[model samples]
Target: MTGGPTLPALPPSLRAPLGLVAVLAALVVSVIGTLYAGHSQPGRVDRWIVSPTADPVGPPWRPVALTLDFLGEPAGSVLLVGVVVAVCLLLRRPRAAVLTVAGVALAVGTTTLLKQLVGRTIHGPDNLSYPSGHTTFFTALGLALALLATDRLGLGRTAGTSLVLCVALLAGAAMGWAEVALGAHYPTDALGGWCTALAVVPATAWLVDRAADRLESAGRPEPR
Candidate 1:
């Protein structure tokens, strides 16, 4: 269902540039993924960020990390999405609700598929971890929220773009840190996951708007 005042379309001036950035971000995920494919060891880049031998997160911060990690899990993700969708509907922002679910789902799905293709393992051969799905989910969620806020506030181009990037960056960094600290993924894997969301969400938002517009147009009565 189309919501009143649909998710604000990215300003026309920003769309082309953002689209290009999305493509480049996606390529970054691909190139790094290919280099590490079928390998379990951390690469030179990963080694530069955090030692492969560092101890897992402990006591004070472990719970915090686990809490963030849990939010990325299936049950937690569902709960989070449900709440967001419910709020969107309450506010008569059904388009925002749809984008929330669709964008996050597409971003996470991209990581899942890439994991299979990249075959980058972390702890063992069976555990694929090229792009971190957890990082993607949080990043996508942040982007969706930022977009909704931007539209609701009628933010200008510079302000809106800044808000969207800042929110997504913070969300991605928070989840990425949790994943790396817990030794679930290499630093590069988290980076790839962050890029995957950056690549997917905007594109998904644009598509959702286009699809909704077309559907609404089709349902409109023709002039007499």
Candidate 2:
């Protein structure tokens, strides 16, 4: 409680936890916006990035999602985290490894819960199908990357860290877009994904980061 490893920021301190909560608050805005703007289905926010396969018969969201597909598969966003963790584990970063694995679980589990609890049917509206799972994974992975890639991982600024971030965002966006392209998810699904991610991802990441920080701080002896 006093001090612990933080998520995305050093934990052991209140600032980091507060910052994470604030960041997650963005999800609320996203959800509310989706409820208001979405016509019980995904809307055409072509202003933002979408897919390209928007044919006359298909859900317009498909083209929007397809358009957002970059580097092909949506897994691009999380691949960076895997690589980072691989390097970290090889380099002897136990904390980063645990957080990466746990974050993935947390993100995926939460998404499944949302899909079910929200009752957002697939293919069409009638349910809360605004948020996209692809988007959830994408955003969740990004949060994990930001949280897990700390001093323990040894990701130097001049080295792979920067590249990892760039790839993560681009990939997540692409994957999220792809959902719409396939007509599997609505545009709002992507939005809900982001909101859910921002809300839960940060909280879990912060909790995990605090645990790591606690261990780290414990290693340092106090000056008697």
Candidate 3:
């Protein structure tokens, strides 16, 4: 059977144990940062960062706050991920789809689990707030969409990747600012979320690529 359009493959040297190690290091650092900020006493990082924007109820900032809240909702995240996955499937990039789905799932699940384990509470709901779930979902989605654009869309890899990265960074930053400005989460929570995506997406993508390689190799007929 004919295969789908191939994505530009990163060298195995970059995608294997080295890449995995880097991703894991990022996760560890972010986890440590979140714990440090969350568990500190009064006047710690969380308080210092949150105190300034904790009261953003004024008329001027109301619209900005509302817009951010709307964008950060779970519905928005699901929609973004759904669209990306659909596009990847349409482009016959099953590996991309798998990576996207797995990255989002891993980021979201890990954030939720960490929140519960950390048990940190702040200005927002009683639910754990060590890491912002909205930030994690959006960031991961952005990264996945960026990859699809570069890999499947046939855009110049460097230019396309850079453009997408900029946009994604802006969106992620906006979400983080909104959450912090509205007192929904501490700044470190946003940081933790971003770091979580950086770690989870690459690791998930590497694993997906490896599995795909194995499946493809197995399906090939033996040489005469």
Q: For model 2, what is the C-alpha lDDT against the true structure?
A: 0.55
| lDDT of each residue in 41-123, candidate 3, tens digit only | 32366677666534665578768876766766777666777888898788777777887788889988988887876766775
lDDT of 2 by residue, 1-224 (tens): 12123333422333344355536555563564445443443345532545444552256665655544432244654565677678656745555566666765676667676665566565455554545656766666665555445343545543334444454556456666576556656656666666666566546656766786778789899989
- The regions of model 3 sitting more than 4 angstroms off are 1-43, 47-54, 57-64, 152-168
Total backbone collisions for each predicted model: 0, 28, 0
A best-first ranking of the candidates according to their TM-score comes to 1, 3, 2
**TM-scores for candidates 1 onward, in order:** 0.94, 0.59, 0.77
Q: On a 0 to 100 scale, what is the lDDT of residue 94 in model 2?
A: 58
Every candidate's lDDT: 0.87, 0.55, 0.68
Regions of candidate 1 where Cα sits further than 4 Å from its true position: 1-14
Clashes of 3: 0
> What is the Cα root-mean-square deviation between model 3 and the actual structure?
4.1
- Cα displacement (angstroms), candidate 2, residue 159, comes to 14
Predicted candidate 2: what Cα RMSD to the true structure?
Answer: 7.2
Q: Which 10 consecutive residues of model 1 have the lowest summed lDDT?
A: 5-14
Where's the lowest-lDDT run of ten residues in candidate 3? 5-14
